[model samples]
Target: MGFFTDCSRALLTILSLTPASNRHFSQHPLALQDITIEPEKASPGFKCQYPSLKGWTNCNGPNSRDCWLKDSASAQPLFSQYDIHTDYESVFPQGIHREYWLNVTDKVISPDGYLKTEGKVVNGSYPGPLIEACWGDDITIHVTNYLKTNGSTIHWHGLRQLHTNEADGVNGVTQCPIAFGDTFDYKFKALQYGHSWYHSHYSLQYPDGVAGPLLIHGPSSANWDEDWTPILISDWSHRSAFQDFYVELGNSTSGVLGREPTMQSIVLNGTGSYTCDPSTDKNCLPQNKRKPIFSKVFQQGKRYLLRLINASTESAFVFTIDNHVLEVISTDLVPIHPFKTESIHIGIGQRYSVIVEAKPSAPVQKDGNYWIRTVVSDGCGTINQSKPEIGVIRYNAGSTALPTSTNHTGLSTLCADEPPENLVPVVPWPVDHQAVNDVLNDTFEAFVSNNVTHGALRWDLTDTPLWLNFSNPTILNLGNTTWNPEYAIIQESYDRGYVYIVITTQAIRKDPSKNTHSVAAHPIHLHGHDFVILAQSNQTYDVSATPKTFNFNNPPRRDVALLPAGNTGGYLAIGFKPDNPGVWLLHCHIAWHASSGLAMQILERQSEILPTIPSLDPTRKTCKGWDKWLAGHVLDQDDSGV
Candidate 1:
């Protein structure tokens, strides 16, 4: 039997063998904070407790916030047996099951006081509902695509789908898109914890609205009095992303060549105020009909854990609240030592879990309100009608007036990630020198070229721009002797060693005229594993000398990191163990660039991938449904099918 099938049978046996009394759900005693366990009706034996429960002092049980699983007396923490040094590739707790259902449909909505008829939403909300679970919990989500004319697939942003490649949910890589009126069940284990967002991987669907927050609760490196739900900040446009993509592609007759789409406004938690001109646009709502500014009520003297995520199409933001110093606790899903900063730069598709004490820099104001700013990073991307002050933080719950607070001075304006030294992982996993040498031997150059199809400009991470076939995905065509060159597959057959990938933007072309080098920084995201950033620099990489500059001792490890821009000859070197036997995607998280073909596939342990999948029956069924629906549709494959 396959790994998933064996897991299913084992789960059934465990559920059936446990006594009825022992299956009763109960919250742990340390659940005094704002975090609460909300089990679904289908999950009968679901039990969740704060990881730092007082009486549970054993090494096998959940450790305290300040304790590690292997060394309970130490200050470093690991969740139960899944601590920092634990080999999460093969070992993880088999926690309770959590089930959720999502319905995706086309709807007309007003997010920033401007109506967009081409909006694609999940469960009738612009920014979909939060999907929460504890670490190691088996999560089953049934996603139904009800869109009248589109195929969809939902990708859980940073979850490592260990041994379960089919659940990764990339449309053209893992599986086919869910056909209209069809429900696809995605089952996988929550191996990593912390907050991330789930969104449609079908073309440009996520930018229109098909997205939501996903929080996998677990132990933290620091303590907080209250935990807030994920705060999603994004650039909102009135027009559909599909229409905006035409401008991005320079395909629209009215659009200028190679121009990025200009967003209309900024939205925080699905609400914003747009300066709508009703005289020129009928879709603009009146002042009284618009939604109020996004705000959060803070209790005095209490520290709050704020999960910050940037879901923008192209813009990078500097997140800050007026007069509040953010004590950053984690980068993406990786726990880090606490560091204080006035503001943080958040790249698109990146997440940060920060602790902000209720104490403001100055004494409490008469209005007790402060502005939450999402400032556009300089040299990043642009928003036409940008509003830095998009939200508010109120000390008084009764206040409805806007904050008169001033902007935080000395905020960083550079379009770069936070300092690498400040993002030190709490639990260090040092890299091997030999592994770094092995990876540097095979370097991948990232560059923009104009020699692609029809001589169109495209960004490439490999030899060619990735253009995938919707009908025949990578998961179904594994173990093949050859692959389509357009698929951009990088094969790594070994299963025992670490895979280090060095991506540099300083690729020198034979014909100088064909080189379309870009100065824009890319937020690179890897699908299957959280890789360590060995070295990142704006200087040109020297294959011989650069190896000495790499930080082999516990570098910044995360799913996404900023690959510096090409103006100064940039490069990003990252390393991850080849433990997950799957065809994982490594791509730029920028919506325009990803759809413009800046991506590649890492086919790790290709020979062993087929044996892990118990059945392709469900995959075949979904593909058949997609093919049948596609036959009657008139949609065009304009860009990359990712």
Candidate 2:
């Protein structure tokens, strides 16, 4: 039997052996906050709070800082707390073990030069803590929530949760949000290797700052002398994400629909210069602290691997380094054939790994610095970025001067995906011609309209916004006949066959009399699977003729892809195998669009999933905690229940 099968049988045996008197159980007391790590030592055995629970054990490890970096002559070798040293070959061999503890909390600070704003951070740091592990390692992360107000959950972006769906970390779908002062353990194997991020999946929380980089060490397509930490590129706003969400979804006096709030600036690695209006603002300049510039020191003729992640809530970005060429190696978590490009386009929640050779033949200014530019793509949204969204790449380590390096001319400002031909996966996903015999083709129309009953503007996948029951996650609702299918798309017994879905979006006016309508591209993200992009085009999809144009042989595979929303209508055709049994979410990565209800659920192999997850006790306990909290407190369900 496989691991899950054995686990299922063991769970059944344990339950059957237990006495009915012990059926009712309570959670362990609030997890202690002191997570300091120290030298290994054994303590006297402590009595179990719940002796009836067979596998329960006291938490170990001295409570110290979870992530830290050591000073180096070249640069700070970035790593998590437990990883004092790392060797790629040994750490990521054929198989290995990895674990971490992440504490989620709220802090008030200005990542940029803007006024102070409340940020939901992980491990007491903005842009959260870095989660580093080796490929094929059995990764375990104990996430403790201390948000004080909102519950939190972290989604490890682009990591195919495989059969371990509960570890997907999507609140309201895979599991309930970890309640304040509660902890949830996420365990899954890192089967794929590349760079991505873990961010709060709870509604509007990630944009408020609960996010961090996740890197899985493995083989790279190209050689590099050193690999720096992942660079996070994002759009910035002065107000909280929750506050901005209200403007997009709230009742409007002006009758305009789908107006995305203008962002204050663009941020690169949580640092930017936001021009503060001193006349209108009291907290103008924060005392004695300059916005820290993201800097990288380079030695001539050496190659550096830079992992780029677009963690923006809405915007797509075009990233370029002044007078430099980037050798692109991977997209999302899929390693691709290396291709050279001057710039690369990245959408929200997407990632790319590229190599840069710091050759002395390149431009070396008197200042010894070059600007790393990230421009918000056109048609995504508007932002008041008077200064460029840039980081500094210094030729010398000791140089503190700014660069006069100029951006490359005529770079494409359009919000679109990289050429499909350039993104061929190094490891191709097999396409079975006979698999289509049992295909489930789903078509959804994307639209923006006014919710007449609620008196707010809303975006729809197919006229319904996803409103999940926090107290009853879909994973726990397996085999539930009473569950509604309005927002859920059910797929069963495909095993390893194709499940095709095509999403099309067109410009639609809130007021039918007006010719103008909201039209912009959306970056759609899928949980639990890396889907094959069969076709993506700005032209309208014809039911009969579109299938002929589909790429059946080794299509571009990724977890996130752009669904073009143009005047003529954009369509994205994607296919994935239903080998992984779990409840999955497909949603637009745009904060505004997803909040307005442009999303859906896929319940795959429900019967199979039930037998695999025989012990639903932890899941039940979480639901109970959520239920108790909901009974006493009122949570406004303005946004989609991500």
Candidate 3:
């Protein structure tokens, strides 16, 4: 595509050097305006409500029992949608089915050609819709929000919603928030496989675009050929990640420390180019009509399988591909042990399945078109983008020309993660207890505080800032044994093997008279366990020299990792094995630092998690349909009820 329209005027002359953002975001309380996007069709004779499952197919008829109408009307391409049987360990002996109806709404388009900004997407497309499944499958999806005033959910990110904690779609922690004409459905179980992504944990609605790409297939530490579809590397925002979470949480007259809203471009799957700035006046569209370009088509020496997703709501990418290299098999949803790299650091809500090897070597490259980069990681934010934010890789599918190659020179813009001994885990997993001498440990310390009472700027772990209770949900007050220690409870109770945890971004001080603590790095995430990463460090931790640099043997487990900030503090030490009971959510996958709270709340085995949830009547009928839309609407609930 003319090398993405000549890198879209060199990425809009580098987003015209930022400074003209905000084109009205945060709408959808039904003030609904403009609205004009169409083309998604395919509800034909729809109907397949679990009709004997297994790759479902029925299409109504024969005295239709109204099977909940959901025909994808002959659609395809999510890496062949799902028949994935490469047998790397193949074991879904049957009971595998999948479905999806999705829909959600709002869209104005212009994914990076600067400012069109309306996004919320899905079915109206935008980074949202590539589901696919197969490892112990049994997924379902449905969705439907039509967002006129926002109230949606969808979080399957790193699913291990084991006892299906209300299918773990957090928005007030599991249930409630699918209201704009509601339709929920989720159903879980692809049990631990390879790729991940499916966002919209409400509040700040996944960087104003919900989000997608969520493969499952099964095993792989090697072997490739063409498994490519799921590359999402976001950071875009002309405005409205719920108004950039009020410029990163600052209200009371914008005083209490809130300002991390810089980004205006760095998309990849949903294209990118953004940069209007005729000096300002925002509302751009001609750069050859928002120059989209996420082309792929590799096939030279063949080895492909690149699932890389870093669905950034707060960047931290680093993935590269110029003279291709990356072998790296699986990370989120574990299955590692296959190294080789040229780049592959991904963090905001991580996921990696890399295995490139398309062999593109050539001279001063002309048409083989490389430039896949992503770079951005000024410790996870601030992406001005002069270059290395690209996406093209086209080993001649009748090239459109561009890549002059080069750009792999001693990289280390210093943001960490992907070096827990190169993430080893081809399924070993043996860490028998001991997270810095675990006596059922549960320590934390992440900071960024301004005493957080009314001075606003909160992001804590200790001086409490969790604040979630949307119509009372701790899985509907799990038999309330009186608990709300700022919801930082870690109540485990068996599955005795590990549970440790000990995060620590050096105690406080974002300027406690300045001694250190403005460093960033914290892609923490952990819901339903994948934990183990005993000891990541920038050193300041010293309970006798950080428990002798703990790593109880086979460490490196996944579901997001990367604590490292530094000055003199950033230790991490995780350890999971509360073998999936429920009410999980260990957070920090920064969507403005987990809505300004940097979360916590394990509660596993909380009295055996509601008798191992098979159904709590669809979670109390979706919390009585979110308490009948919270008794005639009024839900803004500031941030972090996610």
RMSD of each: 6.4, 10.0, 25.3
Per-model clash counts, in order, read 0, 6, 8
Q: Residue-wise lDDT of candidate 3 within 1-642, one digit each (tens)? A: 001223433443343222212111111221122111111111233211222233433222222211111223324322111222221221222223567898889887777776545677888878777777644546778887878777787888877766677778886767767777778787765645667889888777878887878775443556664566666888887777777777777764544577678777788887876555544555876666666577777777777777888888887878888777788876877776688978877888888888787776545366778888787866578866535647788878888776777877898766788788888776566777453334324567787665544346678765577877665668877888877666666677776677677787775323443222456778888886678888888778765567666887878888789888788777787877775677887888878878877787777878877766655666567667767876786766776676
lDDT of 1 by residue, 1-642 (tens): 012234533554454333322442223343443223442221345445434433233232222342222323434333333344443344444455678999999999899999999999999997998888876566789999999888999999998877678888998999999999998988777777789999999988999999999987666677676778887899988888888876767633332236578998889989988886887889999888898888889999988889999999999999999989999989998889889999999999999999899999875567999999999998777888888999889999999999889888777788888988999987677677767235644576666666645335666777678899888899999858899888999887776656788887776332435566667788899998899998998788787789789898789989999888756688888889887788999999888888878899999889877766657788899999999999999878766777
The local distance difference test score of each candidate is: 0.79, 0.71, 0.67
The model with the greater lDDT, 2 or 3, is: 2
Instruction: Report the Cα lDDT for residue 542, model 3.
Output: 67
Better of 1 and 3 by lDDT: 1
Candidate 2 residue 38 Cα shift, in angstroms, is: 21
* Alpha-carbon shift of residue 607 in model 1 (angstroms): 0.9
When summed lDDT is taken over every stretch of 10 residues in candidate 2, the lowest stretch is 34-43
Residue 177 lDDT, candidate 1, scale 0-100: 91
- The collision pairs in model 1 are none
Q: Whose TM-score is greatest here?
A: 1
Best prediction by lDDT:
1
